[model samples]
Target chain A: MTATLGCVTLSLADRLTDLTLSLHEGEVTAICGPNGAGKSTLLSCLGGLVAADGGLVTLGGRLMRNVPVQERARSIGYLPQSPEIAWDVSVEVLVSLGRLPWGDAGAKIGRDAIEEAIAAMDLGALRNRRVSRLSGGERARALMARVLATCPAWLLADEPLANLDLRHAIALMRRFREQAGKGRGVVLVLHDLATAMNFADRVIVLDRGRLAADGEPAHALRSEVIEQVWGCKAGWLGERGMRALSLG
Target chain B: MNRRLILILVAALVVAVPLSLLAGRVWIDPIAPTTRNAALILFELRLPRAALALVIGAGLGVSGAAMQGYLRNPLADPGLFGIAPGAALGAVLSFWAGYAASVWLLPVFALVGAGGAMALLALIAGREGGVALFTMAGLMIASLAGALTSLAISLSPTPFAMSEIVTWLMGALADRSWREVGIAAPLTLIGVGVLLSAGRGLDALTLGEVAARSLGLEPRRLQARMIVGVGLAVGAAVAVAGVIGFVGLMVPHLVRPLTDRRPSSLMVPSALAGALLLLVADCLCRVLPLSGGELRLGIALSLLGAPFFLKLLLDMRRGLA
Candidate 1:
């Protein structure tokens, strides 16, 4: 099912203007913006983690608020930036928390999903280790596995690549692409423009709490738009197809 | 692994119970009773006291674990939210008001006080309050309650009443009978039951309120349950045992390492460990060669727990450094 936000305005002191967008199934959408652009706020609004001051968010043609929490949880997985792990629980057990929405089904599907997510994140070796003992990057991947284990229709992640090393970051982006290929909508709040350009099918750029640009990565990352919205000068150079943006 | 821990805890409890019963001022030979007085001491005094110690310890332990899990702070205790001090104020008020002679009035008043404190805590903390706010509010309420209690004590009409209040505040399980056990059991059981059932919600909460909400766990509902659970358990425990300190805060820390630090897994073991610790402490109070009367349970716990707390603080400082 597709997720849509219609003229959603979230005001937490600063006003986020009318945000209207439709996120289709089977597409990886990267949200990009400068600091305080309300990118994370918009994602939170769509995910129903925060209430909008005005307007509506709907998933699968149903009002987001009207959807039962358990149903919404099963259908959409949200991984917030810097998710705290209060306890030193084992990785496998922490990941299994994702299956809580499904109570007492045959254990096989839950086990399979947990194993697959762990494998996808290359955390099999650290599966039994305490989450508190893991490095920052390992913990991020472990939490990513927790989100993926839910196997939701829509996956919302905020700054998930913040602590990951280069190899793990690339692996995570590839996994997001695979999730999109499998008909799940993957929306990420990303700061790395190069990764967004390389992996995201569509890009939504927020500037000063408003949607500034929304289109294919090539179009949305246009030099003029980047310069205007991000206050930066951008140019593509080298055979590696690197897009560089320097503050003007 | 959990089963082994549980087994070890249960075994320790089994051993501790009999020892607690037999290890008082007058040694009771349970195998062969030397006199009717010994049996009377065993049945009338030690049995009920040991039972009270067990239940109260379990209550504090489970409540502490639940609070820590809910607040996502290892230092979180049942008393951290002012329930114990609130209950203390209620009992003190009852004494000052000349109702200490009534058997049930004191606990009933204490429960009411605990409920009032919890309501105030919730109101001050608000809908989206974080740990810092809750803890700060709790400290404020506790200080207020403690001040009121001291005022009540100072204004007492009789010096005898003031001493009674002092004794109660020191906290003891002495002279407790089956009646006190009956008063504390059901509420503690129900409170522990409520806290135990919130394991999944607590696990989700480790991900923070927003993520927990996204996972379909209602943070408000979970928090409400925790409040009720802690109120009932701690309030009842204070009613019977008179504000025993540190068991709630210390037991979870002791058991968390063995249980892999999973909040849900910590509850039962914490409960068991709390029971064992209190029973042992009570036994030590009886056996120790104190110059005055038998040492109060609360004092003993603080003496033991203060060192542990200091070490924890130093370790935390080191980690920060």
Candidate 2:
């Protein structure tokens, strides 16, 4: 699947500038930027949650604007930056809601899909558990299970790894890796440069609503790019794929 | 447990309906119809009144469930959207203008008022259907309508009209004929139907607005459904029965633990629970030996709602403790 942002722009006080990029399926692409860097806005624009003032986003060679919402949702499962479960429903119930795009939410969630999602999130024991009783990491996994149950073609999560502990964060990245390995599109809006460097096939960095760098993780989030974009004098501590950010 | 609870509510309704028809000031003997006007009273007056109570109560319950679900606020109510208050304003204006003398004009005026409020809410929400903006718009409309209703009560041409306005605004299904029932039943039924269709949308919204939209829930469509649904349902309730309160707020909470707690599943049972509650409450109001004419349904619900609210507060405090 080819996901392209054709100079996508927004007029909401220019929350997003004339940004353009093309992302491919079977790749874990991380959108990395500081706060207010239009990362979330770009993710939303690509997910078709926000309309752009200029340019466009297309999925699988079809213009996103022309795609009907339900159809679009069938192909795109979106998890917000901080997903909120309004009701204290069971994790199973929460996951089943992903079937909403399929017009078969709740009890209509197919057995295979629900079971796979639950297992994918390691939530087999917590399936019947109410969300209010779950820890933050458990709740986050449950939220991911919900999006996974949709079995969408494009899985876009905003800061999905933000609040997780180290173990859960890496576990979640592996899940994204697995999804990408399955020939699906996986896009994440992440603020952690090291995580992006370690886990992302490619990284796109933004600064001040504009694209700062776009390339492989090592090139896009290199020392010079971080200096130019984040205004932080930083260095990489480790080597190659297992690198960590070290500040001066 | 969910299915059983719904079944229990249905059974209660089945039992309660005949009892409501029988438990009024003039208790009807089911075995032998003796009084000359027993058939007249039972068929004409009591039946319509009972039907109206069920219809209005169901409407309020569904509207409340939908509103709470859509807004992601348990404290949310259909009345907060201003349709009920707007309808009440229309009815109050009909009282002030003395057009309530006609059989149809009051509900008609209330319907028009509900329509106006709906239009204004739509205008304020506009193309940007942000939940915060939509909610504020609703609260604003409710406040304006409430103030206008108060003005109508105060500026009544005569004390008689003022009393009439106040009494009607207190909310009652007493003396409602089949005509009121006829007008409300279809509109409310359609309204509930519309909200039920939005059940999935409300469920998806548990993930919040942007995520819900990404799930294919066009917020504006859901917003429109809510306005039309709540407007018709709550508007019809206020038009026919006056400003009845608390049923919407209380019914879903009372039934929440019984169901899966999904916003969509909550509506039907809440509607059933609302109907059963109003029927029993109205029966109690009729049977209670009150010095004043009869306990108004609105006041009765407030009395019930207040205790539930207190219990909720105490429970929350205890949980924290």
Candidate 3:
């Protein structure tokens, strides 16, 4: 499935004007931008959770606006920048919420899907524990597990790696890669440009709500592109697939 | 739904409702039941009062659970939406207008007030129906209704009318006939149906608004359901039983520990628990020896709820609950 954004413009005072992008299944894409650069906004628009003031978003072929809400939810899984668990439910219970779009959630309908998501997030041991008792990293994984339980065609997450430790972060990146390997689209909003360069198949950089760069990591995030978009002198260090950002 | 809790509450209610009839001021003996007005008291008087208690209590419980879920705040209550206050304001107006002499008009007036409040709340919150804005609108309406009710009370034409208003506002099921039961039951049932329909949406909200919306939980639709459900259920309760307090606010908390802790999971159990609590409390009110008269059900609950609230606060403080 292809999620297409055509000249999508959002007026939030920090305008996202005439931005067009396409995301494909079976690939990992990263959206990188400075704060207030419309990264989350763009992701929300693509997920059909927010309506763009101008232009259109098409999921596969149908306009996202015209897509039924439950169908859209079934097709797209969205994780907010900092998801909150309102109730102190068990991790298993929390993860089962992803199956909500399928209806009969917490029942036997999506049991296998929930198990797969819980396994993918490595939350087997902690399934019975309350979300309120989980640490920040654990909570983040639980939130991720909830989205993954939906088994949507497209997974759009904002700042998904912020609270993870190195091992968990690496593990999660591998998990995301596995999802993409299974012919799913993985779109993440990343503040870590190095991680985007190292892990993402495609990177799109937004500057002041405009598309500053869009392509392979090496080309779109070249030293000059970084300097021009970020307004700072920076250079990429290390070899491909393990790149780091070195500042002057 | 917590099956064990439901069973326990239902069993307890089954026992308590019958015993409540026996324990009232006229203590009817089960064995050798040959009292002059035993049949009249049991069938006509206590039966309807007990039914009203159950209906109103269950309504309050479900409303409280739904409100807490919608706000994602444990402290939210049926009164938060201003429907109860709006109903009170309407009833007070009836008294102030010297229309309290008419039985049907008072309840009709209160129902109209509740509808008006529901409309104003929806209008103020608008289509987005975001939680924060919805809560703020509720507060605005509640405060306005409260001020207006106070004004009506203070400026009541006669001391007799003022006394009647104060006593009624204390909240009770005393002297209520099957008529109150008829008015409250259908409304509460329909209201519960509406709230139960919003269960999935409330469950989705465990992940907060954005993620819930992503899960196909429409905020505006949920808000509309809450407005209508709470308006009807709580409005009917207050219209018949006066401002019976704390059942909606307290029942969910009392039942939450027994359930899965999900908002949807807590709702039915809360309703059962609320019914049980109100029945027992109303029973105690009927039997309690007060020189002035039988203890008012509203005062009885507030007395219980205040301490429960303080304990909840302290438990939260200690992270033990």
- lDDT (Cα, 0-100) at B93 in candidate 1: 85
For every candidate, give the share of true A-B contacts it also has: 0.86, 0.91, 0.89
**Model 1 segments beyond 4 Å from truth?**
A1-14, A104-106, A238-242, A246-248
DockQ, computed on Cα atoms, for candidate 3: 0.89
Model 3 clash tally, residue pairs: 0
Model 1 complex DockQ against the native: 0.76
- Per-residue lDDT of B1-321 in model 3, one digit per residue for the tens? 488888888898888889998888888998888787999999999999889989999999999999999999888889989999999999889897677468987888889889889999999996788999999999999999999999999999999999999888889999999999999999999999899999999999989999999999989999999999999999999999999888888889878877889888888888888888998998988888889889888998989988988888898789766
- Model 1's CAPRI class? medium
lDDT of 1 by residue, B272-296 (tens): 9989988999999998878877999
In candidate 2, what are the lDDT values of residues A70-135, reduced to their tens digit? Answer: 888998889998888888899989999888888755354566787889998899999899999998
Candidates in order, TM-scores: namely: 0.94, 0.95, 0.97
Candidate 1 chain B: worst 10 consecutive residues by lDDT? B312-321
* B231: Cα error in model 2, Å: 0.7
Residue pairs in clash, model 2: none
Interface RMSD of 3: 0.5
Encode model 3's per-residue lDDT on A1-248: one tens digit a residue. 12373222222212577776777888899999899888888888888887765656787677777789999899899999878888889999999999989985656759988998999989999999998899877888888899989989888899889878888787778888888999888899999998899889999998988888999999889988889888889998888998889997
Question: Which has the better TM-score: candidate 1, or candidate 2?
Answer: 2
